[model samples]
Target: MASRFTRLTTVVPQLARGYAAPAKTVKVPVTLFGLNGRYATALYSAAARQNALDAVEKDLKALDALVVKDKGVQAFLENPTINRKVKLDGINALLSKAGKPSEVTKNLFETLSENGRLDQTTKVISSFAELMSAHRNELSLVITSTKELDKATLNKIAESLQKSGLSEGKKLLVSNKVKADILGGLLVEIGDKSIDLTVSTRLAKLNKLVTDSI
Candidate 1:
């Protein structure tokens, strides 16, 4: 019996070889949704089968960097008016210039092109990175504050998180986001849970308290 992925492979001739079977044991521990997640999961399966997970990750990081740094390439991928062939060629040239493009990566690019889904390039790449982070059993710690956090303060917060049992034993991948609307203090999100310590939240609470007392 052909597995669902096997049937899917057949839909794209070039991808069948890459997505056939994982050469090594690779476990995807997380579930994702939506279009980007769907594509990223499929690519993860294909890369795992080829035992090229790291290569694919490296390719994605490089590609993502290109998308961020190069306006022309970024615009090209986002432009729906451009035909599939042109986008396909452009991606190939960009990868070639970067270095030798891995077979699985190239196959993914071609599949996206053929499906006229090049517009999903950025989201897919980001979603794949998220998968990689999950595979490493890491927690995403987003620290939002009214001002940029200094390294020392960030380190202290990370150390506290490490001991606070909030990370649930997984490694913490900490990042800072500045949101002036928070007014003051910090807003921390660890995975699905969040802590609102910002002045805005406190003010709202205070207002509610006063209103209830009236």
Candidate 2:
């Protein structure tokens, strides 16, 4: 399956030939790592060539919602015991009932099914979303604190980051996540870089230093 996925990644343009526009290279906005990243990048390139990025994204969002709401669908995807052909048929039927999704969207699912990667549907969708976000020049900023931070604080942090050149001329999408284990301080993740200022991390470092001395 891994080898098949690798091969599929290179030939994605061929798979999307019927649906996508004339053969032309479409560069991805950001470089993602791993198998899912490769799949997502291929999908993005295909969608971009087809001029159906928004449509494909909408279809994937709806599919994501459906998977979250329907445990049966979720279980079916993760069940490796199910035949790939059966899964492919089931997915096609589901997509048909869900309305006419763009050909590029359908091709994505078909490729996943054929490659025995039905289980990776969710991850692929997420990675595709990340590509879309990057395509739109949106930088994701995650702020983790011991408790929920107010909007004012979040905005201030985002503004500060922008001034500090962390935004790199991109729009900032700020989100706050609460992690009580942090005890105090904040952990900021902007794009691929992270700044750890959590009390827990400081204490751990101190403990390690003391142990080394002892």
Q: Report the Cα lDDT for residue 11, model 2.
A: 46
> For model 1, how does the per-residue alpha-carbon lDDT over 1-214 read when each residue is reduced to its tens digit?
2222333334333443534453454467688888677778778877777768899998888888888888888888889899989999989887886799789899888878867778889998989899999888999999999889999999899889989979889999989999998899999999999988999999999999999999
Candidate 2 residue lDDT tens string, 139-201 = 999999999999999999999999887789899999999999998999999988999999999
Error of model 1, residue 187, in angstroms = 0.6
The candidate that wins on lDDT is 2
Candidate with top TM-score is 2
**Residue 165 CA error for candidate 2 (Å)?**
2.0
What local distance difference test score does each model get? 0.81, 0.85
Provide TM-scores for the models.
Answer: 0.87, 0.88
What's the C-alpha lDDT at position 147 in model 2? Answer: 90
